[model samples]
Target chain A: MTFSDIPKFKLKEYSKAPELSSKTIAHKPVIIVGSGPVGLAAALDLAQKGHEVTILTAFDFIALGSKAICFAKQSLDIFDRLGIGERIIEKGVIWNIGKLFWKDQTNPVFQFDMLPVTNQKNPGFVNIQQYYVEDYLVDALEDMDNVDIRWGHSISDIEVRNDGARLDVDTRDGSYQIDADYVLACDGFRSKIRDSMGLDFEGRIFEDNFLIADIKFKGKAAEQRPSERWFWFDPPFCPGGTALLHKQPDDVWRLDFQLGWDIDREAVLKPENVEPYVKGMLGDDIEFEREWYSVYTFQCRRMNRFVHGPVIFVGDSAHLVSPFGARGANGGLSDAENIAWKLDLVMRGIAPRSLIESYNDERIMGADENIRNSSRSTDFMSPKNEQSLAFRNAVLELSNDYSFARPFINSGRLSTPTPYHDSPLSTVDNDEWDGGPKPGFPCVDAPVNDNEDSNWLLEKLGNDFKLLQFGGKAPESDLDVINIPIDSLAAQRYDAHHGATYLIRPDQVVAARWKEAQADDINGAYQRAIGAA
Target chain B: MDKFNDTVNISGHDDIYQMIVDLHADGNEEKSQKINAKLIIAMINQIGSEQIVKEIIEMVRLNEEKYNPRSSTH
Candidate 1:
């Protein structure tokens, strides 16, 4: 809803709460709350599965941070599966090569090769603005016959029932009631639907705020091209300031301003104030210009429960991570990836409602990992405590020496995908090297046959629960034989884990790492996930 | 509902990584837990991140011998 709707959802009387009331049940098959990345994904995903889907959003797409860059390879595979990968790839910038400028005196260093040859289809993450990705998703959803995005619409109430949920959505047009078998809340942090349903969204909030300024690069580029992302640790302009310079479009750099506590947002964002920083870092080459600027605080908070009744939170609604690990949007997109398929299966009656529980469980693990990594990175980059700041400075100072310092610097101070060691769905043993893709499958090359596209394995099993069976012969015809490669990399990767077979779920976590395929056991594994005998 | 976990995500994992492994090995979360954490720490330690290690240690107060994540890489 609007800011005026309620400061933070406080009710003196229990019965008066809209979420607790009976008036909140759904008549429709599924109603999605909030049309950010997660909402859009769920809507598109469910609609594709032959279910009617509607999205409610307080703001339309434009105000959306159009330039939120950084899409991981995993997210790319998800995008490709949604059939929007081609369009996204066409529109987004591939940030395969990245350079780090410590200071003018030091040589520019590179950390990651944008498109490393990972087993996945896409290289690394693509640097498309978040707004562009949203536009693409909105366009894709609009075309879908079953999906409808109601912009300028606000969800006023949420009431869960036995069979489904009921939502009273107040749009700019008018309010209407829609009943759905399930409700998806991708409403984002400060989630209204989540609060109404009475769920816990907990975690730490960092006091230091971040000022993000998106400005066009009028200055000439050095030897390094825009294909790579640049981070300046220290330069005359912004000493002790870490600025992430990402290329938006031709010569347009999206600069993230790590503002100090006392810095005035207005003064810093001004073209004049911004010019000095630009000149100091990039050098006085040409004209100074800017496209957009905004400032927001970074916090690492996660919802205690993802599901309450029929309403489930996704994306920002589910968690908010510091931008350090590039997990903010990427993690949200992954939430969409994890939830969409299961919701689709449930809608199609392929799986039971209980199977939907996996979404909250699996995704929460992912969010926790993301938050943990990003939090670490934020602390190192912008330490609030005095001693911690000194420690961080020491690390940076030591980084100048290529030999000893490189190791610490190389181990990216922040950003890591956490491992899920214990989950009901996982079958990985934290054991030593037996081979094949282990439980937490790291990106390894999966070979394809002649004439077949190199990305066959990745494309085939982008976001579903993929079963990579090197299974010599089919145990039975019932098993969904998702084209396992022969002598190819995928086969080899799984050769040790399961001689003839391996089960990989949508999120790329190993469902079952077996040495051979047992017809009875194999079928049972799928049954457990699907809740079918 | 006690804001079960508001302002933060509490939904995203559902794997009985422990369960399945335990079922495979006859119900042992301790051994299962230790090795898994070690393996993750091993791989992650190799990948390197002073910050990640510090935060991870803070999150899970495992009273095991200290394995400086940086030392593993070095």
Candidate 2:
């Protein structure tokens, strides 16, 4: 759908919830706040596993604007598991190469290719509006019987106890209380739930303000533009600042112009003021209309801990990072993926509650990495002081001449899946192995033969604990076993010997690996992976 | 009169500054000064470029001379 055709703040109809007396209060197994992408994905995951989930949100509609246009392949894989991958891939624009240009330079300084592997199931990144992703996820959630998504329900008060969390939610009719076994806060950056709990989101706020405008241009000229991420340190078109151009589906493009902190925000947002900037970049020949516009300041911050007793923060509620790397929604989706399985296992009594602690450890590390990369990107793009400016200019200048200096030019590192190398659940390697994913890393997808059927290795290993034995006899175990031939891509990727075995976790992360298969080793690894050992 | 690399080498000065601040957190100024001096020497050795080291030293000296409390009008 075109940008103009997309509805703006189209609120869904939410039936008024019954008034609650103290005795009539309902206790839910899981209560998710905010109907954003993270909450919707979490609810769907928990519900698909036969758990009841209640989603409470103040707004009934999906987010307005094309706010968060980029979705990483790792996130798409998670969405694939959630049953919306095909729809998202169909709707989103896929691209991998990004060109970075220096100020007043005619040619790009550096270019990066995110997905070097052509055989992967998903592309490196897809550019789709955030609202469309939420819409697809919400549609999926509506079909499930185990999920109850309550719209227009604002959370006014929250109380956390040892056993569970009590939330006082305000609806259109009246207010009601919900006693939930666990609370997942998918609320946006300005989270009231986090504030009520006295948690602090601590980090730096950049002084630069970026104006994002989603513009739609019809006909031949728009179609001819390269469908890749284009970033400029300073162009003659937009002097003294940075600008970014990203193509979305349906003849629309997202343009971001960095306006220094001192400019008048209201005056700069005017159509007249915005037109000149667009005209300067694209020339007067192209006829385009601005679909949406917003001014945003970058902030890199996160809570000290994600898990606070029975209440846990997910997505933007837990952490906020600068938008340079497209880490916001993609990071939130990863949070949902990390927490959903742990919460499901805990709720089903399959694993201890302590399993959730690893979610905090892993996601916190992910957040810190994102913050560090984004902070560096911001510093390079908008130098804070004279020394930084000098260094950035020198890098830009030298990048033209020397290939070694090209690495120093940081536009945005771009988002990549965070590797949980130091995770507590990952078993330390005991034997020497060649080139493959180490323990604690997410499984890389490769083509494999499953019973004469060609399938992706990741497709065969769904969201479950499985033991993969490459070129070896299948050991007797309670876990599902997948034995592949010696010469397959799976075997090659794992650097597998005749009897090498890998213990894959429910989240598709390699928990442990052994040079030789042993039933005892597999059992021990499985137990430790699920937090039983 | 040494010709250095004439290229930007040190990035993330804030992080380096923060590390030094953390190192001097014990409130021992004399010890901190000694540690800073040792660190400079170690870094210079690691860099292994006499011209670059001399240029850096000159740059720091110039900044110190310009911004020192005794030299400031206020």
TM-score of chain A of each: 0.87, 0.96
Predicted candidate 2 versus true structure: per-residue lDDT over A40-118, tens digit per residue: 8899889888899999988866657757899998888898888899999999999999998876666788888889877
Worst 10 residues of 1 chain A by lDDT: A8-17
How much is A322 displaced in model 2, in angstroms?
A: 0.5
After superposition, candidate 1 runs with Cα above 4 Å error: A1-26, A64-67, A114-120, A198-200, A218-224, A410-418, A428-433, A440-445, A453-455, A462-466, A496-499, A506-508, A531-533, B1-74
- Per-candidate iRMS values, in order, are 12.3, 11.6
At residue A415, give the lDDT of candidate 2: 84
Please give the fraction of native interface contacts (Cα pairs under 8 Å between A and B) kept by each candidate.
0.00, 0.00
A18-56 per-residue lDDT for model 1 (tens digits): 223345543567778876666776677667667888776
Candidate 2 wrongly placed segments (more than 4 Å):
A1-9, A19-22, A451-454, A497-499, B1-74
Candidate 1 local Cα displacement, residue A314, angstroms: 0.5
